[model samples]
Target: MPNHIDFVATLAPGIFSYELATGGQVILAMDVGTLVKKGSDVLVSTRNAVKAPDLGKLKQVVVQQYDVLDEREKMVRSASAKLEASLIRRFVELK
Candidate 1:
């Protein structure tokens, strides 16, 4: 099994992005303090591997720190969600 998985979370609106390996140590190391300071909404994007049934444990870890959204819910909240899906694709292509 892979020790780490790539996933995206909606931390803010203006594209505050960063990639740091948790080293299989922490499930989420998001700076909630900074997020609070920035007054950004916390919404986890469930568009990809994040919805895998095999990742239930991983999802649990994330759910502890942030709310998990299903596809239907995501569509309902589309106005507030950031465009991390496309951004991530562009990033991966760049790499």
Candidate 2:
């Protein structure tokens, strides 16, 4: 399957948010089979996709991606404790 970034890029511009709502609806409706099918579709579609770079290369890419932000912008975008906590929890669960 494609790496997460590529998969998301290919699917939709806001699939992460969309998926949360869609998946929640599916769960609430008790449609486990549909949810499984959706997951299977993602895996099948991305089975032959290119893999992402290793950690070091990805770090460089992240730096480059954020390089356009000036000091003020960086400050404005500075991490928040609440956001960090949520991200950390997701990261830990995913790992």
lDDT of 2 by residue, 18-71 (tens): 133245311111101211123324422321112223444444544554465466
Model 1 Cα lDDT, one tens digit per residue, 15-73? 22333356332233333222221223333432232222234465574565345446557
- Clashing residue pairs in candidate 1, if any? none
Stretches off by above 4 angstroms in model 2 are: 1-39, 43-52, 70-95
Q: Cα lDDT of all candidates, in order?
A: 0.42, 0.37
Worst 10 residues of 2 by lDDT: 26-35
